[model samples]
Target: MNAGKLACSLLLSLLTAQLPACSFNMNVESMLSPPRLTAEQEQIYQKLQNSVGSQQVRLKY
Candidate 1:
């Protein structure tokens, strides 16, 4: 292969290798404002909080 083509291939392979290390989090809205729970769910959540320390539990679904 020509030098220019070989350089391009090398750069492309390097970029492709880095793809798996990249991540994109699209759940910004959910993280910013979690959904509200129903009455029964809230009761259960309170019980969980009481069982475990409040700081140790985060309901993410």
Candidate 2:
């Protein structure tokens, strides 16, 4: 590979090694702020919010 591409590849590899994939987690509130919505979007967002009050259990084997 060319020098520039090689340097980028090495930098990315080092970054990933130091910070494994699971170490990165997004802050949901900022990612999805309340926005102006149409009727359908509002309805769906309400339904999603309602579901948050309920709990769903999962078994990871």
> Among these predicted structures, which one has the highest lDDT?
1
Error of 2 at 1 (Å): 8.0
lDDT of 1 by residue, 1-61 (tens): 6999999999999999998896778787756966799999999989998988747887778
Q: State the C-alpha lDDT per candidate.
A: 0.87, 0.72
Candidate 1 clash pair list: none
In terms of lDDT, model 1 sits at 0.87
lDDT of 2 by residue, 1-61 (tens): 6999999999999998987556545788667754577899778767776787666533233
Per-model C-alpha RMSD: 8.2, 11.8
TM-score, cand. 1? 0.42
- Model 2: lDDT to the true structure: 0.72
CA shift of 52, model 1, Å: 0.8
User: What are the TM-scores, per candidate, against the unseen true structure?
Assistant: 0.42, 0.31
Off by over 4 Å in 1: 1-32
Backbone clash total, candidate 1: 0
